[model samples]
Target chain A: MNKLAAKYLRPELVPTKACQGCAIGAIENWLLQAIDEMELKQEDVIFGAGIGCVGRQTFATWGGDNFGATHGRALAVATGLKVARPDKKILLVVGDGDAASIGASHLIHAARRNVGVTVICEDNMGYESTGGQFSPTTPAGYVTNSSPYGMAEQSFDPCDVVIAAGATFVAETTAVQWRQTVKVVKLAMQNDGFSFVHIRFPCVQNFGASALGSRDPLVSMEWIYDHTKGKTDDGAETDFAWETGIKHDASNSRPEYSKVLRDLNARVRADMAAGS
Target chain B: MALSEELVAPWAEWQESYQDGQRLLEAGTYALTEGAVAAGLGVFAGYPITPATDIAEYMSKRLPQIDGYYLQAEDELAGMHMCAGASLGGQKAMTATSGPGYTLMHDAYGWAIVNEIPVVVVDAMRVGPVSGITGAPGQGEFYVSRYCSHGGNIETIVLSPNSVQETFWLTIDAFNLAERFRTVVTILTDQVVADMFEDLFLPGDYGALSDIVVPRRHNLTMPFFPADSSEIDLPPNVIGEGTGVCVSPYTHTEEGYDIEEMEAQWSQTFRLINKIRHHKDEILRYEAVGLDDAEVIAVAYGATARTVKTAVLEARRQGVKAGFLRLISLWPFPDELFERDQPYLVCELNYDGQLVREVMRAAPDKNRVHFMGKSGEMHTVAEVCEALEGVAKHQKMPQQPYIWTEVR
Candidate 1:
């Protein structure tokens, strides 16, 4: 086992049940690297996840106290946990389906409230665990098990949603951008308000076979790389491009959701004491 | 207006101990808020809905006064989930909503139940399939509260309070039960009970009543869920305490890790179901009047029970052997309460019967069980007396205006 995995993850669940060449495991390693760099102890962080490929693969991998909420409600749970344990850090690792689809309302509201938590949306583009169903984040014109013809709907950036909802920090990275992903995650955790890190990863078995017509790990990764750069190996323009890196950074500019409540309580108690 | 009555509940002791406390006339919502505060509530997350909006308003103003957190979530789904999260993080938490908002909370309800996170939920029921009559009372959630969450192999602790004073103590009992059972306890009140103004006595010192209020305890050892065992008062697992507890929405091992074996499923189900089933004696609470010599009984719960009790006394005044049985605890069916071989007339606030089905299933004779359901209003004392007298004389409910008697 890698040193960080041994230090931060459960031993029995180390080799996650993720499919071979899935980016979920690799992204988790990057997250651990960020946490290790910050020197945060296992107990200082409360890991939470939602239901999907990211949720299944990453759930309970953390050595600290963790919870896997019902689909799309991780932020809601994290909101409560933050208020109760304001001194501790909360890290929510969920999928696109959980963060942007089923749990979209919570996501927007958590950002609006500026809840103190770091959300690592491990986006695999499609619902790979449920057999490559087309998700809201799946690029237009892409084919999946659910959308055999094409992904007819236009995909919106979750980054834009959170930024509009008043997130303190927002960043987007890909699976292959190891250094940038780790640094961005570290910065996200440092923010004392809602911070979202969207990392688009590749799914080799289902997404590759259904959309890119290849199950080869290299082929799937090269496709993501091409999309990241908007060019194929032969220098031809790809169908779409993902503008990655730090999109917004307003860390601690406003009061965090839990601290707002704490401040209110303090003021109320002070008034009561003076009156008495 | 005297009747032979037997009260079986924890409050029977509380009323005596707090006899010297200050008395006041207040709404039921105020009593619920004060009850939760006295019970050491640390967090309240709620979404405002009719018949229950006052609770959220009261909590918002009162929680900060006592240094508790009040979160007005975006919706009931987020509200209940936030309560579950707060409870898991080693604080007593609660949420309040009516039928419309309560239906949105089933997902979080099941999540809290399976994970054994202690939380108190208040569903002030109004007339509804979906937001029917917002200001009127209804007993439509009787079966809904029993089967609160979607799957089988689970049991819920549900309590109903008829008056503002009972609502105060029952709210405290709900929190205590939630702590002892390590599960969600639903206070299945209705609009009338939630909004009614009545006499309420609040204890002078919450600090002095610490013995009755179950303080939150953290489990730091392994076997976070003592699966396969029917134990009570196990300390709930706490997050952010370095316990490495894993709480999720799947069948789990005793250490709280997700497991996928038949044995694991059965063991977890056994713990969830039998913990309350085996300890029903501790959870059973009811009020009975003149059952020893009565041939017919008028049964009800929540607001309707208030009027039914009056109707029973009036029936005795007219020389009829009518009794009153009011259920305070609605779940675990209280099968022992129906062991008597007498006719029962179930009165409720919904045209379609809910509690009557349970009465039919638990009583000796399903044919002898009659339903008097009224929607959008309470059962008048006269209506209840008429049903009781008709059942006593003719073994059937007589035709009446706006009273439903069919339960098929």
Candidate 2:
């Protein structure tokens, strides 16, 4: 076993169901690495997963508490968990279909409310788990099982949506850029208010073979990085248009939902005592 | 840690501050919301739907005062999911909605049931196949609450309240049952019961709050469900409680991990049903008036029961042998209460009969079961009396099957 795997991964739960060359495995390992680097206890963190290929990452051998939410509703579940246990850090992991399609409303509203939770969207372009159907994030003219004649609508940019919806921190990276993905994920965990990290990855078995005209997954991943506009090296000013680094970072003075609730209760108690 | 004394002390004080001579008059929605607070509700999330909106509005203003959390979710689907999430985090959470919103919540309701997460859902019935009427009273959701979502071999606890006072007490009972069984408890009320104003007796004395029982975590070896019905009373380990537990909606083994084998699935399904089914005697509740010696009996619940009571009295005055059976617990279908010899006239405020179907199934003779119902309108006492008169005159009212069509 590798050194990191020996320390962090559950030995009995290895050999996952993810397809060969799928980025989900690598992305999950990177997240665990980040968690370990931060020295956060497993008991202090909870993972909420939406349904999809990426959602299966909730079973990562790290042995932390995991909640499997319904399709496109992980953010709502995370919001509730954050309110119930504000001391615990909440992280939601979802795919494109779970985030941009059925769960779009939850994503926007959670950002608008500025709830203290981090959301990680692993975009594989289409719905790979349901056999490669067209999704909201499938690029226009991309061929899929549902859209044999190519997608008719434009793909949605979730980072822009969350930033516009008042997310305190927003970042976009890809599985190929492992270091950058780790850095941003760590940053999101450290941030206070609502944080979003959109990671564009490749589905080896489905999207790679169907849309990219290639059976090899690495080829499809390289095509994605070459086409998207982002910095390939370190020490560059991150642009807002599909930039690999932090897209929007602002100091939010607005109170988080849980903190506001706590303060309000304290104030109300004080008022009652004074009146008495 | 237990809930801080300061957090719950004000609510206790508020309950005690009611004057001894003053009678509190409030809507049924207010009573239901206050009852949730009294039950130690830690989180309340919901969307605004007709007749049910008052419950959410009242909770929005009151939950914060008690150091509890309230969220106006994007929709009923999200609201139910939030309630499940909060419940899994060791909080007693609840949500309220009407028919349309209740339909949207079916998926999450199933999630809570399968995972054994305790949450309360209050469905204030309004008319519907599709947004039928905002103010119309209907019991169309009676069966839907019992067999909701798309699955087989599923069971849940459902309660019905006919008046504002009952609405308050039943809400508390719903929470208690939810905690005890580790299942989702639904409080089924209708538009008439939710909106009607009445004199509510506010109790100056408060009972000790029921303790929130969280399951002990066995580290990585924690099993969410017990091996057999013998251990069914144990609560499942919650997330973020140092359990390192994984909760899934798919058929799972005792360790809370997903399993695909049929034996694993059957074991879990059987336990889910038997947990509530075996305890039917403890869960069943109803009120019987004069059924002992009567030749004819009327079965009713929710708002329609009020009319049934008066109609039964009128039938007796006119020398008709009629009695009333008012149901409090709708699900687990109190089948034992159905007498074999007496004929039954089931009344509800829906186009097609919902509860009458259950009555017929439980009855020894389906031929003796009759239904009187109307859409978007309550059955008048006179209408019920006329039905009782027909039974007295040896007339037969055939059973009506539930059908879907536009409500006119």
Candidate 3:
């Protein structure tokens, strides 16, 4: 294990169950870099995860207090946990299916309430854990196992959705952009209200095989790099490009959801004392 | 009519310990809310639904006053998950909803149970397979509460409150059990009990009743799960306590990490099932009247118990030996109560006959157990009395309007 990972991750669970050549572990290392840069202890942060590849691989690897919530409900749990322990940083690592599909409502509502938590939505574009089914974040015209012909539906950006729902901080990065990913993650953790960091990574085993027509890690990495730069290796324009970087930066602009409750409690208790 | 009553519950002693309380008239929802507050509830997450909506309203106003949180979730699924999350973060959390919302909570409910997160869920049932009569009462979730989450290798604690006063004490009891068992405790109340105004006694100072309320304790050491043991009162694992505890929906190890091994599965299931199974006596609570010489007994729970108790008294007035058995604790089904070799008329608020099936499985003779199912409304005292009289005189229940007795 690397130095930063050894500092924050469980030694026994260091080699995550993520597939060989998959970027889940790499993205997790970037997250650890951010946490280490902030000088946060394992105890100072609580890791929450949703069900899917991202959730399973990253769940208990955080050698800290952590929870693997039911599919798509990690944000709901984070909202409650934030209310109970607002002093601690609650970070949720979830998949595209968890954040944008099954758990979309919770993601939207948590952002709307500006709950004090940082969400790392690790989008692999497909349900790679369940054998590469098409997800809501799967790019249009992409061929997943579930969408042999093509993903008929247009893909929606979770970053856009969270921004629309009033997320305090929103950022998007890809697997190849490790420096930007770590920097933005650090900024996301600093936000007192809801912070959503969308990191799209490659699934070499399934998504690479079906979408990129090869299971080679190099092929998938190069494809993601091309999409990030919006150009191919030969300088031709790519079909789609992810407009990466910090999309929104209204950090700590409003009181957090739990703070609102606490303030109400203070006011109500004051009135109760006055009435007595 | 005078009836010999035997009330069996821990709160009977709890009531004696805290006698210096104020008596006031309130709705069951108010008692439930105050009961949760008195039990050191730190968070209540819920969605507004009929009959149970008043609980959300009461929680919203009451929680803020006492340094507790009331989160109005986007839906019932989110509400229950939030409660589970709060409980994981070392708070005594609760959520209230009706049938439709309760069904939506199954996913999070399973997660909480498997992880042994302490939470209380109030399913104030309105009639439904899917949002039936919203304002009417029904005991439709009798079996659903036991198999609340999918999977058979688990046990649940479910209680039913017949009146407003009981709802208060029972809510506290539910919280205590949730802490002791380190699992979800469901209060399967109904519309009538949740909405009706009745006399409720609330202790003057909740802080003074520390002996009665189970305080939330955190497990800060290793072996977060202890899946091999059936022991009670092991402090629940908290997320922000730096315990490094791992909680998930999968079968887990003593250290709380998920494992797919069959040995791990067996050990976890043993702890989940046997914890309550071996300590059934601690979880059992019921009220019985005149079972010694009674020829037939009227069995019921929740709102249906209200009229059934009256009917049993009226049966005695009509020169028939009829007994009354009102179940307060519904799950870890008190099969011991049905040991008496006599006819049991299982009265419930659903025509689909849920409790009757359990009564059949428990009673000494399956043939002796009869169903008296009614839906959308409470059974009138007259109807229950007639059913008791008919069962006493004849071998079966007499044909009655809107009452379905066919259990097959």
Candidate 4:
């Protein structure tokens, strides 16, 4: 599924160090294309990569200026980098565990200030990062190394969280859809305020069918493609669809979105009960 | 030439200035605040605390006048994080706090260093590990301010400004150096100087304040990182994506993904350290007063250096030929300094006698540094003079020809 991206030699920029099906490969492509299409320069950017597999690799292969900070602290570092250099383009890339778990304070306030930094939570569910331990995004009723009896806590919904945090622009997409993902990321870059994009990526080594028996994200995202009502100014009421992401306004109002997460969890539980 | 802001801002400038540590710290705050703002630090996120609170007042009142943002954050930790976030967005950012507020930011500081975020922190050192003695001024947190936030072999550049002039200029320089080296630069002065009154010379032009070179907004030529090691010829950054970059605390591949190879570890560490090490000429600064033909050199910093200067002169008058080395850039250890010259004794007011040990480690021939410091009491000029005279009396080295007899 090598989709033709607009206007550039993206392969030279794409690091070959990543494995065959690493989720970030396509993500890297989308990000570069978005930067090129949107005419971005490095001086305008300072990315904070949280500690984890992705954070470490992003620092090694990413040729841009960035601060590869502590584990579970992408947003915390991003907060400092942004405040110190408010005129530069700022981004934070974190694992679901990094964002929703330890660095939660920075994540919430970064969104709360609408502090004008972009966050890309590469969600694979669970800390597939650290040998498949349960994370803030580990699905309930699913089994992981740390959740052998099934994940006790519910999963976190990033799209809803961002919308609630008063993020000016937020979207959910995956690495497979190169053009669309690039579109969302580029659009976020162009935004004058804070932007959040959570990618529903799957870790081939960890959270795949063998690990959780969950459907492939490529197939799962299919439901979103058909169910998602396109953005409309008339404020159309859309139903709560797990595949389609959040339907609420993308402004400062996270509490309402909390219900959406709760609803998503209940729906998943009901389905699990029926299957049993 | 012109009435320097460092001069006028201090109070009234003269041939030379001094503080015996019983400071009017109020004037020092004005110097630091105005110096930073004038250096293009227009954003401040802080929680109010004694000694450091006046800085917030000035930022709140002065920043709005110049289109700046002064946010009283939810708490000290959040405020510090806000300052961190704002800096990444390309604002020369700063925050001021005393011990309790500073302690809350320990882990966050490590994150900033790991991420390579350039920020200026003003710590008005007070007594205590945790609110031990918030009130009565004590230079206890000197070591905490210097070494607490180390994620690895990362360095924290600390500047101690003794007088109001140095306070203003040091803050201005802290902003410049932090932006230049891309790390946290601290103005580690005590509450005495923190609350003192003095004249300051506000620089006419923030002297290259707005000229901070951030990561260049060049198009992602390949990705942020190259796929192979050979392709890592990272060019000079030229940024245009004012809102395109994302900052994190993790070590992602150049594409901003995670890595675990020996290669990633070496590369990131190399890059992080090189940012400061490569800029050694610009990053490391110090003042050597009367070190040329001296029997003994007193190495000092911040408020203590002001006291040391007076003692150096008194020892010279007593024909002991004592000298002084004032460390403006405390971190990076200033190893090159001790290499060319020796006869050093580090003086500070701390219980653990921390920085002096660092000074000794940096020097080739380690000497037992006689300390003239106490936790609560100030490091006075008379005490330092007493120590220097004692060193001279005990030294086996020959004395200089033209003798400066003791006046009293």
**TM-score against native, each model:** 0.99, 0.91, 0.99, 0.67
Candidate ranking (DockQ, best to worst): 1, 3, 2, 4
Deviating ranges (above 4 Å) for candidate 2: A3-9, A228-242, A251-253, B1-22, B207-221, B230-232, B397-408
Question: What is the two-chain DockQ of model 3?
Answer: 0.90
Compared with the true structure, model 4 gives a TM-score of 0.67
lDDT values for all models: 0.93, 0.79, 0.92, 0.62
Q: For candidate 4, what is the total of clashing residue pairs?
A: 129
User: Per-residue lDDT for B266-334 in model 4, tens only?
Assistant: 776776666666666665667776666666778777676777888888877777778788777676667
Considering every candidate listed, which one attains the maximal DockQ?
Answer: 1
Question: Per-prediction DockQ scores?
Answer: 0.93, 0.64, 0.90, 0.19
Tens digits of lDDT, candidate 1, B1-408:
455789999999888877657899999999999999999999999999989999999999999999999999999999999999999988999999999898999999999999999999999999988979889888889888888899798999999999999999999999999999999999999999999899999998889888789999999998998878999999998998999999999999987888889999999999999999999999999999999889898899999999899999998888789999999999878999998999999999888888998899999999999999999888888888888889999898899999888978
Best by lDDT: 1
Docking class of 4: incorrect
Off by over 4 Å in 1: B1-3
Interface RMSD per candidate (angstroms): 0.6, 1.3, 0.7, 12.6
Among all windows of ten consecutive residues in candidate 1 chain A, which has the lowest summed lDDT?
Answer: A201-210
Q: Candidate 1 iRMS, in Å?
A: 0.6
Q: How close to the true structure is residue A26 of candidate 4, measured as C-alpha lDDT?
A: 63
lDDT of 2 at B304: 89
Q: Give the per-residue lDDT of model 2 (tens digit) for B1-408.
A: 221111111222433544443358889999899888878888999999998999999998888778888889999999999898888877889999999999999889888888888899999998888798889888889889988777877888899888887787678778878877888999999999999998875554333433322322222345667645633456545777766677776777776677789998889878888888888876777777777567788889989899888998898888787888888888888898895577888888775778878888899887778777777887777777877888766756533334221222
